[model samples]
Target: MTQAVAKEPAARPRRGPDRYVPFTEHMGVVRERAAAGEAVFSLELREELLNNHGRGHGGVVMTLLDCAMAHAALSRVNYEREVVTVDMHIAFMGPSTGKLVATGRVTGGGRSVCFCEASIVDASGDVAAQAMGTFRYRDAA
Candidate 1:
């Protein structure tokens, strides 16, 4: 005699603005809707994302900051316009564990360029990293 084994269903891919962006989707970033000039993003830390010290990788933290700041710059412009990072400076405050939450806001900008800042906080509510970025907006054809 044999008995059937139950299997768990596969997890569904997240859907939203993040899904539309290939890199964001690959990174499993969740985009939280926010008012103009602001954006929020979140990511779950996995073993693969850890550094040698068992903390979140610096590259991952930088990517999160870049994405968040870019999103913030985009928020202040027309949705059809594209924004590209011109310069970014990041400071890692401390190691991070568990889920990472990032928030970004546009500080200032002109018609063609914008300045933005972002901060990442760990699940424990400790700030893990912060960044300031300059982005240029490309007009749509």
Candidate 2:
């Protein structure tokens, strides 16, 4: 006689971030796509992410924007050079819903800094938020 047992499966391995980021990991932000001057990320809407108004928290939007912009900046150097956010401005365009996708693109920059813009689109493909940011390349410490 043999006993059969089935245990829960392990978590799926993700391609994930190039570098460790606590907040990004905690927020469950997934890297959808990325390139030299562009990046895309997504987050599944959950109760934990909602605000008092029952929509995605503004901070969540900002976090996604920041991460996306930073990824875009890092990709410019093939994910070798690090970067720090110098400034950011974000505008919320609509209520967040379902899964959200954030897209970031490098507009322009010099050797020391990168200028970027990012936008979050709701599941319906409507823009929910937009952000502009400047990131400076960090000198290795």
Candidate 3:
């Protein structure tokens, strides 16, 4: 009898406008341009993003915070360079419903690393989560 093996699926190449930020497309994140070293991202509440308790999932909120902080760090560098998360800390303040908005700003940094802070706000403008992150800048290619 011949042995059978399972294969993992291949990663797909990103295309179109979201190529620079592919996750934004997958997560349905929308961006609002901000000043240098700052970023703003938003998403609408959907059933798929909700947890069993009918609130936004913590993982999704964390992802939004991370992405916002990463974008803030990236804004400080050349477009050809990308920022990778080094360390992150987050705090959940409350449940999130309706439209969610995350805003991030670079607090401090050096040549290769940046420090950033972000907060996720619900439709009522209440902070649902806060996060701090350290990111390292590197060449895209």
- lDDT rank, highest first? 2, 3, 1
**lDDT (C-alpha) at residue 37 in model 2:** 88
As a whole number from 0 to 100, the lDDT of residue 99 in candidate 3 is 93
31-81, model 3: which lDDT tens digit per residue? 776458898989887999999999999988999998788878877773446
The lDDT of each candidate is: 0.83, 0.87, 0.84
List clashing residue pairs in candidate 3: none
Candidate 2 structure quality by residue, lDDT tens digits, 92-139: 999998899999999999889999999999988899999999999876
Structural similarity to truth (TM-score) of each candidate: 0.83, 0.85, 0.83
Model 1 residue 126 CA deviation (Å) reads 0.3
Choose 1 or 2, whichever is better by TM-score.
2
Which candidate leads the pack in lDDT?
2
Question: Which scores greater on TM-score, model 2 or model 3?
Answer: 2
User: What clash pairs does model 1 have?
Assistant: none
Q: Which stretches of candidate 2 lie over 4 Å from their true place?
A: 1-17
